[model samples]
Target: MKVVVQRSKQASVTVEGRVTGEISFGLVVLVGITHEDTIQDVQFLAEKVAHLRIFEDEEGKMNRSLVDVGGEVLSISQFTLYGDCRKGRRPNFMQAAKPDEAKMLYEAFNEALRAKGIKVETGVFGAMMDVKLTNHGPVTLIIESKEN
Candidate 1:
């Protein structure tokens, strides 16, 4: 499992001109699952993102976690994160998990976040989506379960 986490002032996802998910102030989490990913990976990432301390505190220090700031999450399933471009101009997506397996893990990840009392929103899985966001501080981080 891999995730690109971005702090956003506001964010929304549109599928076929209809808003699927939106958030006022929170993180836009692009989640990617690989062939080797499992439920354990989903559990690990959900916990990590929930407690990530990227938000700034009163002293202007990045000391507050998403839980502390009461921030929401706009989770999007993004198999493209695993695209491999080492061979040629066109990316290879062999590293991405199959749709059925990926969808199960993706939903599990969201459920884990919601279990933590976080307001989580998501885009339609396997749908063509247009995402918009005002990136707060442009603060972004890439997290991977395999690294752990």
Candidate 2:
């Protein structure tokens, strides 16, 4: 499991010109799943994302977690994160899990985030989605469950 977390003032996901999910003053999470991912990976990453202290404190230091700021989450399924470009011009997507397995873990990951008492919104899995966000501070981080 891998995730790209970006702090945002606002964000939305649109599928086929229809907005499916949106959030204000929150984190936009792009999730990628591989064959090895499981419910445990979902659980671990969800907790870490909730507690990550990327928000700023009164002194302008980054010290507050998303929970501290009562932020929302706009989660999107993004298998392109796993694209392998080392070999040639064309990025290989073989590392991305098959849709069926990936969707299950993806849903579980979202549910895990919701379980953490934060409002979690998501893009439709396997759909072509257009994500828009005002990345606050441009604060972004890439996280991998394997590395943790």
Candidate 3:
């Protein structure tokens, strides 16, 4: 499992011209699942994301977690995170899990975040989505379950 976490002032996901999910202040999480991903991976990443101390505190230090700030999450399934581009012009997506398996893990990830008492919104799985966000501090991080 891999995730790109971006702090945002506001964010929204649109599918077919209809807004599907929106958040005023939170993180935009782009999630990717590989064949080896399981519920354990989902749980780990969700916990990490919820408690990540990227948000700034009163002293202007990045010391507050999402929970402390009462922020939301706009989660989106993004298989392209695993795209292997080392071979040629076309990126290879063989590393990405199949849709059925990927979707299952993705949903579990969102649920895990919600279980942490954080408001979690999501884009439609397998749908073409347009995500808009005002990236707060442009603070972004890439987290992978395999790394930790």
Candidate 4:
């Protein structure tokens, strides 16, 4: 499991010219699932995302987690995170999980975040989505369950 976490002032996802999900003053999470991902990966990533201290406190220090700031989450499925570009000009996606399995894990990951009392929104899985966001501090971080 891999995730690109970005702090945002606001974010939204549009599919086929229709807004599917949106959030204000929160975190925008781009999630990816690989063949080896399991329930443990989902659990670990969800917990880490929720407790990540990217939001700034009163002293202008990044000391507050999403829970402390009462922020929302906009989760989007992005299998391309696993794209392997080491070879020729084209990238290979052999490491990405199949749609069926990936969707199941993706839903579970979002549900896990919701269980933590955070308002979670999501883009349609397997759909071509246009994501828009006002990145706060342009703060972005890549987290991988396998690596940790």
Top lDDT model: 1
TM-score for all predictions?
Answer: 0.98, 0.97, 0.98, 0.98
Candidate 4 lDDT for residue 141: 98
The alpha-carbon deviation from the true structure for residue 87 of candidate 3, after best TM-score superposition, in angstroms, is 1.1
Task: List the candidate 4 regions with Cα displacement exceeding 4 Å.
Answer: none
What tens-digit string does per-residue lDDT give for candidate 1 at 1-148?
Answer: 9999999999999999999999999999999999999999999999999999999999999999999999999999999999999998999999999999999999999999999999999999999999999999989999999974
Expressed as tens digits, the lDDT of each residue in 1-148 for candidate 3 is: 9999999999999999999999999999999999999899999999999999999999999999999999999999999999999988999999899999999999999999999899999999999999999999989999999963
How much does each candidate deviate from the true structure in C-alpha RMSD? Answer: 0.9, 1.0, 1.0, 0.9
Residue pairs with clashing backbones, model 2: none
- In model 3, the runs with Cα more than 4 Å from the true position are none
Models ranked on lDDT:
1, 4, 3, 2
Give model 4's clash tally.
Answer: 0
Per-residue accuracy of model 2 over 1-148 as CA lDDT, tens digit each: 9999999999999999999999998899999999889899999999999999999999999999999999999999999999999998999999999999999999999898888899999999999999999999989999999973
Candidates 1 and 3 compared by lDDT, better number: 1
- The TM-score of predicted model 3 comes to 0.98
After TM-score superposition, what is the CA distance of residue 146 in candidate 3 from its true location, in Å? 0.2
Per-residue lDDT value at 30 in model 2: 98
| lDDT values, one for every candidate | 0.97, 0.95, 0.96, 0.96
